[model samples]
Target: MLCFGIILRHILYQKKEAMFWYNFETHNFETHIGWGFLSAFYIASIFALQVI
Candidate 1:
């Protein structure tokens, strides 16, 4: 019974850690893409307005 409890706790801990990493990675990706698109839009607008 004691061994079973330990195994369950370890599994839960690993799962929580994995979830945290996944969420962090997803948020980072979203932030990067959002900023990239925003910057690109501004740059394109500037170029277009320059009439070049």
Candidate 2:
């Protein structure tokens, strides 16, 4: 489970462009909110699966 979790995290981070400083400030606030919502949605999906 730990390995699978790490792999999922790696895959998600790999596609993201602004992982650090410079591009961070350039992006709009809505972009960050969208990412946050996406992350939350994935997390909730995982939890729902576990519950089932």
Candidate 3:
């Protein structure tokens, strides 16, 4: 996706339509906290109990 965006901008710049390459910046930092970490820790704990 990053490569595609860069290529698109390059093409627009080559055509001297640099203004077309301009885009609004947006970012979303919301995410599920500990989604993977907790799952992995749970699995590892279970495995450790089995080994013991």
lDDT of each: 0.60, 0.63, 0.43
User: Model 1, stretches more than 4 Å misplaced?
Assistant: 28-52
Alpha-carbon lDDT of model 2: 0.63
Best candidate according to lDDT? 2
Model 3: runs farther than 4 Å from truth? 1-33
- Model 3 lDDT at residue 38: 45
CA displacement after TM-score superposition, residue 24 of candidate 3 (Å): 27
The numbered model that scores best in TM-score is 2
Candidate 3 lDDT tens digits, 1-52 = 5555556546634543322232112221222223335445645755665566
lDDT, model 3, position 31:
22
- Tens-place lDDT digits, model 1, residues 1-52: 5555456556655755565577577776765565556556655655564564
Q: Cα RMSD (Å) between model 2 and the true structure? A: 3.9
What's model 2's TM-score? 0.47
Better of 1 and 2 by lDDT: 2
Error of 2 at 46 (Å): 1.2
Assess candidate 1 and give its TM-score to the true structure: 0.45
